[model samples]
Target: MDITNFVVSARNQALLYGDYNTYHKQLAKKLHNCRKRLNIVTRNRGKFSKKEPISAEKLSENHEYLHLQLLTAERAWAHAMRFKAVHSADTKGITGRTRSHIISRLDKGARAAETLVNVLSDASTSGASDTDILEARAYASMLRGATQFEKQSWEPCLRSYATARIIYTALSTSMRGDIFKDLLSETIDPSIRYAAYQSKVPRTLAIPTIARKAFPSSDSALVEQINKLAPDLLKKSDSDAQKGQVGAPNAPQTITWRSREVKIEDAAIALALASTDTATALLEEKLASSDVTLPREMAAAYDEVLIASQDAADATKHAIDELKEEGVSQNDPRIQSLQITRTAVNYQMISWRIGRNRVLSGEHDGALLDSAPTTTRKSKKDATSRKPKIEPTGRKISRLKDKVVLYDSTLQSIDSIKELPGVAADEGLLEQLEATAKYFRALKSLSIARSHSLTDQSPNAYVLTKHAFDECQQSAALFSKHGASSSDSSPRNIEIRQADIQFLHNLLKGELQRTRAIVQIDSQRQKAAETVPPHGGSPLVQRLFEYPEGGANLNHLVDFPPKMDVIPVKPLFFDVAWNYIDYPGKEPVAATTPEPEQKTKQQAQSQKKGWFGFGR
Candidate 1:
């Protein structure tokens, strides 16, 4: 049966909505239902029936009996957890009585689990599978570990927890779920670490190594079962633990950052750093052999190195946190050294992360646009050979957008490196990081420009392309001045190669010219379009405001041989000139007008009446 699943699901369902007390109540109700189903429950008002211990025969008869035993054990465990949580805030600490009470509850759970294990182990009578037996054993060991943990018996607690861890770790390999992993990470690992610490195990040893050492080797059956599940796990753990001890071959004893080497005091960091070195070598070998590797494949190859570096960084952070928790002052020599180590590991991690982005961004860090073949024939190949298919403009634009995103990520990673503890104080390193950021920014601009060009936005493309070119130049100069020394060549991070910079410089130079030409051609085309008359038949005189495109359409010039039409002149001028000069055929008649005396008198009277409508 899936014991872990059953227990975890019960805990989650109860604890998510309530707490352990609630879980205990729920388990009690479940136990009652199970007993009722088995027809062994006491009747109301009847004499109490003595509970009999669960046995293999009952489990064989009905699997519900196993369920009943599991619920009983889980109820007890929850009750203990609830009691412990309730008394956690006591100022004085847990009293001896309360501690004993808690341990009693845990012991009861352990006994019930042990009973289940015994029943399952009797395979001939219980009809239990090997896997079911092992699961029961692991669960029982977990409960026993909890009991010992509460009792402060560190060695026994470590041994019991290690057994559970080893079983769960083995089972997790064959199982396709995270239940075992969750138990290991969330429950068993922490308990084991604490118990090991209390048992005087050195903090330098990793939890897995500790668990392996404390695993009950005397239990032949357990060892055989775990071996069958994971054949090399025990041997591998031994080898891993040996890799970083003093005088071990290829052990990472120290790490160098900016020519300053610091000793690797923490075994976890040392192990992680050694793994990183191995991963870096492997990555280099893979990349070197696969000349035509895909971008994503190359990126995937970096994951191992990235993970190792991140582990080192995390280990460093954890060490620092542990020291701080112990009330070690910031000015302590150990604290100061750890801070430096933290910066170094974090920088290395970010460097590899940026390297992965660089790989994804494509050749020359995406400075050059990869043009698709548009021709079917080449001088070097057969004419009948199929040509590479050209991607659609939309697809090309999408690829450029992807490159832009990678460049943006690279820029962000470079920025993050600046925030590391001592990076900003290191002038040369800071310059290199800034230069790297500028380089990625240039690449991002180039990507954006290429996308714009694909979308027929010539002006925007030209502007962005020019900006990219300028940024690339500035970054190249800075890189040349502040680049890492030649002795530091490694595949762990991006190296600003002179050849790559030159190639990108040439490509961006040509791209700037190409984009400029495109812009000018587009502008000329627009100007020509604007100069074209709306009506083709309009004469030059009528279209004087418009520039003559296509040489003014000379065939429709000036209405050809000019057509006759009425023209307006000043008629009043002619009338005035006629009066000034004599005409040959016109008689000189009286120029004076004949006026009526009555009209003159009325005009004079009106002029007099204008003043007041009456004369005074």
Candidate 2:
């Protein structure tokens, strides 16, 4: 009763009586149950590793049972296919042919499942440990079920593969059998191995074995193998499991397989399988090998060459369109008219010369000889040259004479007064003379109106003269009284009527000259002052001297009166008298004193004469 030989014999017995169709169906159901159980175990003990003796042994045992059933199905399926193929060739009637064809088809379908199972079983027999056995069984079962599912439905395959994967996972951690470890190592996919290594499990009692009765013959063998292996298996399994659990205590289990495809068409999928550095290096190498130069200009030329050419008519049409947009016309009446008018105008002068030449050549009629002789008429005289001479009318002449008389009278009076003797020396005489001269000047001015012939006589002239005469008379009376009261020795008492009049005349003439000079001087001064700053001292101030009475004196001849009337006339008169008295080149007269005794005797005599004359 060696464990290995017993397993082999049980596997053979299962195959010998196995109805491929019936066994596959039953095995698929059992496998499905095992798959479910293993999946649950794998999930619960997710931290266990396929390398752990306990996990591997458990998983391998379940996979061994699964693979044994799968092998039996395979052997049965091969015999069925051989029989069906021969039967199909020998059959002749339609019914036999149909039955043979059906059997052949069924055999073909079954063989496909059997081939996958055989491949998986071989992997299981190799050093495939618990996880390996489980993964191989799952993969094979999935393929076989997939075929059946494709022919029939998906429920059978789905249930079988699911149960097989679960059962394998559970048995792997349970420390169930010795062969289980070997089976796992031989058949477990690398990805699932890694996943089992990272999984976790609770420290709890084992789950009740409800399906143990189903594997009655293998149970005793399984327990005995497990008893012998569990000591070493437990130690190794716990150690490996703990190591695998380091970073991922609850890591999910995954299935990994070698795909049938040796080369991948999609680079992305290939890159995914490659290491990071290798992938990066390959990408860079591809980039280096690629040609980056673009044929842009050549492409453009190719496109241009492919385009259809524009005909002459089309070009002309485009040009016409452009001209229309620019508001130009090929044939315009106004443009033609302008051209014709310009040409005619340009040649008109030349045409006229040609016509004149023809006429001179006498190529035309004798009309020139019949033309009348031209006459030259005298030019009329200008209207200004034919104007009448104007005579001086009497009224105008009389008015002229009157103007002359009035002017002469005013001048004569002013002259006569200025020439009087003693007027320059007399104090009051100059004032009186000025009055008279002023009156005469007024009279002369009035004469301008009388001389215009608008009036026969000027009342203003007579009134001015009479006023002067009255002022003269009053001045004369004052002079005579002062003269009679003063001694004959006093020069002021001397009456020089002629000198007084002469001084007045000079004064009046000087006044008129001074006024005119002022206007002219002001004009010149204004011009000169224009260039000077406004706030500077006036040029007029420099031109005149200031008098003691606060008035301005122009050359000692004209005196402008004080602006304020509040100033006393006595101070003004004293200033004028002082100026005159102190004048240069003038002699001062000496005063004579009277004798007291003689003055007393003269007074006594005057008194005696008055009394004696009354007595007589």
Candidate 3:
């Protein structure tokens, strides 16, 4: 080698080292500049891009290139704003969380790019790798996509995100599916998914399926779908019932005494309803069959029933008092309304007991038609064979009209319970209590509606029953959903409440059938009574007025509706379906009568299935 050539080569090497160091310094500053731009852009710091120019223009292509690339992204974002596709949220809002995620993806992608540039821009680096350069480029593309997302330009956003994902996947040594999932996730828009959800219900969303029960409205379908599939959201809850926990998993606070008490009372109310129903059955059965005969066994059974009802009433009262001690107002509609129901039941039940005793003692007759001569009295068997005879007279009409008033009072008591206060709690128990209040409110409505149907001259029992079913079904759905339970099939659902509602629903149906029977019975008696004449009328006056000359006493002209031929309708009520005055069935206790329509065991099972097959 020539000596001059050797010295020149050494000098050239020195210049290369010197220039490379300068490049390294500028590369780091500019790469950092790139990240700052990312921060500013993703956060929406400025309306326009190019807030400042890149520094150290004379630096190597490695440093200057990335600076230019970043600028390119900024320009792309600015240009994309011209399109209206992404501006839909201009009126509604910044679209939704999708827009938020898009921005986050772009920010993260930019950071990834900065990292790549740092690794490749090291002073010791031989040169930048093609793969590293491409990754940085991919991040730039992601920035543009985020901008489009903010503008509501979903199509462009999706394309840009797709491009970024492909670029990341191309890196053989890169992290797997999960690490780059945000890039893939950015490609889809939640708003679009929501729109799709409204038209078609999704059977399998990523959301916890239990939550779906809470939302049945048109808007809920998409929300449910998103929750099921939402990668970032809470995980799919247990597939089956788990041990009940003390507090809802999602709740921020723990369950407290107030919440626990609320649960207990709600459960108690349901039990009381069951007890009340049992008593009602006994009281009605005894009073009904003994239309003309007071039997000790029957009275004794009714007495037991009355005692049970009183115990239930006492339990309810105790619950109300506890609620008051918990800061709930005495005037609170919830407790007050329940009190009204209790009072009405007490007054009406006592009156019914006294009235029934009068009939069994023979102080009042069971014959509920216009009075007939004592010699003309016919046996019930013979009467059933006769054609429809009884018709509504002024006295009968008056009786029915009064029964309507009694029903109205019960209805008013129920109305007062509406919009009542729920239990107090820091936790989600408030939501549970709210649902409970609604269910109880519905129960009261059914109770009143049943009474209303009995007193109503018009047939509306079926419609009233339908109203009850609606309330219960909706409440049941809510009860099953809100206020998390420890397990999937926990008793936290207050199954007894549902049981009472269902039982009441069945009774409503039976009540309608019973009402029809009463109408028929009245018809028969009216016709039979027409065959008799008025008591003690003058012959001259009777002839002139078309009245009969003689008949049975006026006081014995009619009786309450006859006992149901099968089993007496459970919990027989006292009021006549008349206005202004209520005349109870006024019958004494009666021995158990084998139901006329009693079926064998298999027959009973078949009938039960027929009535409740829908539940199965």
Candidate 4:
């Protein structure tokens, strides 16, 4: 898998962790778009739009007016559905009303396409050229985009729109005046169009748009429904699975993802989970050690899980074939695997995911082990104006021990699947994997050093902290040595690198040097004490015999680490699942899955007409 996309996707998911309706609805929208794109592209029989290009167009000036109305209605209906999806994503919930209206609009839009097709079928004179057929196809494609948009199917919606743009651009070259104006009259928003066609996320993706805007937040309780529905990646999620698109007739793979992929992703996930667990544990330790209810670093602990879970979810989620732009049937099995690994991607953390949010919301002391007991509350409108007979209950709380247990259990489960067949890493991926391990080890080390500083008065705290600082330096060097920084210049990368540098300079030159200034027991008390300020100068080292509490800001020590674990990944995931057919690989259990077809670059170029894009 492209680590960057995988990380980005995972982060987006974890951010919406407590709010699943938005996430699932968004996923469903993408799936819906895939199905619509499949329907339009396969049925139309042409590269530009429908399956076939228009060979002719013969319509009187009178009939032209009716055609315009139908075409206009089709585009309008499609957009209406897309907007409905956006609303659902924003609200973090979907309504029956939204689905019903979308279905109604979709049907009308389909009818419009049929009508256009019928009208074009009758005329053999003026509108029969490739451009006319393409125009009709573009309408069909746009209509597909509309339905996909309604579902908020991310890529397919954009792909459909992009495909339409390419067709319209081609048509525009040959035709002009009212005919062209009519065709170009209703297009998707420019930003969306650009992002979709270029396969790039628009900078303003998170910003509200005129065509698709975010909805108001919904009740938190609804999240429970999603948790009940899907407990983990091990089970098929209800989001897109209910649509029957996965492993169904509309399953979208043109290539076979092999066993080797399953191995690499599983390892990456295992490490991410480990990191999350470690971070959460450290924060729990911090919470337990002090009278302070919250630590400044507590948020960072939550962040570690947020980052890790997103990576885990992305790695573990089932794959769809329609997302692939090209099939890699014939290629090196060792080198070319799906962007997602072919391993049966399964992991569970729904309860944990929900549990984390509860823990954060003060619903728990630390981790949640069970559901809340029933409770009663007083109503403002009560005649007595008193509390209800049943005792009222605030959100329940769990302990740090329980939270650690759950985190450990979660990691253990993933560890079970870490060694599926050919999941071994290549040289480059191995380096990335090692770097990930070393990175977490460094995190745990820092937590240890922090805890030591909190309690230890001996020079041990300084010694331990200095070691942790050294580990950070080594991890940064390891990342750079593995070429992560050069390959990815994202802000996250810069942050990690800079943090490491800052800590290294402070520890080696400042902290270590400060330790020498402190009064050592072996030295003359007068001389050593004179070298430094009096005791209790600063809390950071007061107990440690005079370290500065005014030392490095802890934020730099524990900001979210930039993950650069991408190995020139070819893609993920589950093709067989989408087709709803589970057949074991013909190869032996110990053997790897191999490729079947290899279309050379020459063959690809020659077959360009089969794809939807401008000639250039």
Which candidate has the top score in TM-score? 1
Stretches of candidate 2 exceeding 4 Å from the true structure: 1-71, 80-147, 158-281, 285-616
Per-residue CA lDDT of model 2 for 202-275, tens digit only, reads 11101111112111224343334434433333223322432332211221111121121122221111122222
lDDT of 4 by residue, 218-288 (tens): 42322232233223311333322322211121211222233222333222234334444554555456545
- What C-alpha lDDT values do all the predictions have? 0.81, 0.36, 0.42, 0.42
The candidates, ranked best first by lDDT, are 1, 3, 4, 2
lDDT of 4 at 583: 49
User: Over the stretch 212-272, how does candidate 1's per-residue lDDT look in tens digits?
Assistant: 8899899898889889998876766545555633223354777788898887766678777
Residue-pair clashes per prediction, in order, are 0, 57, 31, 52
Instruction: Rank the candidate models, highest TM-score first.
Output: 1, 4, 3, 2
Q: Which tens-of-lDDT digit does each residue in 437-469 have in candidate 3?
A: 455444445444544554664245445545655
RMSD of each: 12.1, 58.3, 35.2, 37.8
Candidate 3 off by > 4 Å: 1-61, 75-134, 140-157, 166-616
TM-score of structure candidate 3: 0.20
For model 3, the run of ten residues with the poorest summed lDDT: 240-249
Structural similarity to truth (TM-score) of each candidate = 0.72, 0.15, 0.20, 0.25
